[model samples]
Target: MRLFSLLLCGALLTGCASPPPDDPGGTWINQAAIDAARESGRLREALLAYGPNLEWQIHPERQQASYSNGFELVEGRLQAVGAGQWQVTFYGDYEEQLRLQGDQLTQVASGYWPEQRFARAPTRGDEQAPLGSSFEQALYRDYLGGDWLIEEGQGQGGLVRFIDNGQVQGLPGAERFALCLAGDCAAMSGEHDSLWLQAGDQGSPWLFVHEGNRLRIFEAHNRAQFDEMPEYQPGPQRWLLKRR
Candidate 1:
């Protein structure tokens, strides 16, 4: 019958060329390349010690995969393989190829191994920073370098200025770093939306514990998940700030 109808049309084109099944669930953060490296300034305080508050956490119905600097994804599955491309396959076997662009999700590794990007995390209020939280490494080596008055009390105060390049300023209406306004302080220099720095590019990465000079601020989840190698105590939420 004409070679069995050409072998049943080559087995229906090899079952429609297989490959395409792996959804993987929840958690992911690159916040569009951390908001495009905090808006072009190329924000890089060592990538804020890889702590932008938990990034990546697939589940695939329990196939497991976790990472926020702790690394766990012993096995993986992301496999989209088309339009925006994707292919994951974790540590056990190791494979990569993820690209998205719009919301950013890169990870096209091969040899040098660095790519990695991600996003899509804020589903609700978004707050998860407590796994050995050094508060983004003590806000990038001690309260984000320079200029801070913040004494909001009797004399009522505000004059932040942290600027290692990411830029930030306060003084004018200052509704607590309201994207800078005191006469256009560069319109919130490289926005990261600081509530105490929430992911590089500067300011409000939260969680502090200085001590001698006082600096205890913690509320972004109530802080208490130690493991990044110990040495960090001060959890009661006093919101004390002093580093002029």
Candidate 2:
């Protein structure tokens, strides 16, 4: 009887010591990190740690696609060349690359990336540049900059000076890129995330995400252009910053 009782206790203890429930909340991939990987075109390797620990041997030649968390994962075919630098061929024609330092990204877009906006450049000033001068640019330059609002309008506006601490100065908002003001505001977080004024629809926004040397402007959803007005669509747009 004594032996049976000891055995039962041991069994109960063993059962209790078994692995706890799985992490039902799922993996820890933030939208920013995922966007970073996708922009770098390294979506496959970025996803390696998301699922069960499986020994995945990435074959460059024969592997048509990779799988992660039920998403028929494909190789972003992103190449990392040391020191957090990466290059990607987005949607085939669009070429982009990024250099990441700590949490800052300097994004570059060329070839197909700027095809649509190329025509507008010759007629515009710094504001119309893909990297319109903004407080964010000031931060990148001095690492300590702020701005005041000069004007505001739909599709066009002017900021007296774009600054880093837009919140502290109580500056009225201005549209930076084609994204709406609200879209640009939501992208503001810490010193890491990029900032941009959304193009149209003050409510919908464009999120500035810094991944590697690249800073991408993205939308949270999709809509059609109304009477030549830019529409907000889901997915992100990566713009290369021409170093000044």
Candidate 3:
């Protein structure tokens, strides 16, 4: 029966088809911010700060999520109410309603929150550096976390502030941390006086050493590079932003 065989084959193929990658099970990156950085001509700074190389993991099965820029982890009750739809309640009466459209997950703007987009990560966290210690984490939160005005002639003049709430640029899904949080400060050779910090995972990390009335900024890729050339020739002649 040719018709019977055709029907059976169709059923078999349907049963064996792989699931879509849209499920909220893997990693996501702040692509919207990345695009903004590229447009603003701060692609390198954006990549280091926002970490285009980094990833944010979402475990739908465990109802857990981890941000790559080393904020705190979020655990909540994730419920699938419909296809491509999920609601995560992290705290009392606080909800993070999500919508998955192909590669982008949008936290639909609700109440005072605005819409934020996160693109699926190209790779996982296996290839990246780790976030620093609990003690170091506290220091970073207190020391480096502040409202900063990206001074003119520095990099690109703008408001680069790290808020108490887990949002960068008034959007969700980003946090700031010490770029050298893994206890590698001493490795800065003699440039040890400076504090290196990273925000989002997009912008490049900047070194801040308290110099007189302002926190002088030195731009670099990461801590490992800084360790190799502490007396980095370019030296403290750029980025005069203050941590207000």
**What lDDT is obtained when candidate 1 is compared to the true structure?**
0.41
Which candidate wins on lDDT? 3
Model 3, C-alpha of 26: deviation from truth (Å): 0.4
What is candidate 3's lDDT per residue for 1-244, written digit by digit as tens?
A: 0000111334355433333766776656666544544344333344344442233456786876544433344456778878898877766757767788877777667773556677664333222323212223222334445666656443446555543222334112224433342123424423433333334455333454543324455554343454454332224445565556
Highest-TM-score candidate? 3
C-alpha-based local distance difference test score of model 3: 0.47
* Segments in model 2 whose C-alpha atoms lie over 4 Å from true places: 1-162, 165-203, 222-238
Per-residue lDDT tens digits for candidate 1, residues 1-244, read 0000111334445432322333334446545434443334233322442333325655445645445532222346666667756566766677756666665556665763566665544331122433212222223323345655666432237655644333345633222222111112212222222233322333433334344444444433322346432222233463455667
In model 2, state the lDDT of residue 54: 13
In candidate 2, residue 145 scores what lDDT?
Answer: 30
Count clashing residue pairs per candidate.
7, 25, 15
Predicted structure 2, TM vs. truth: 0.20
Model 1 C-alpha RMSD vs. true structure (Å) is: 19.5
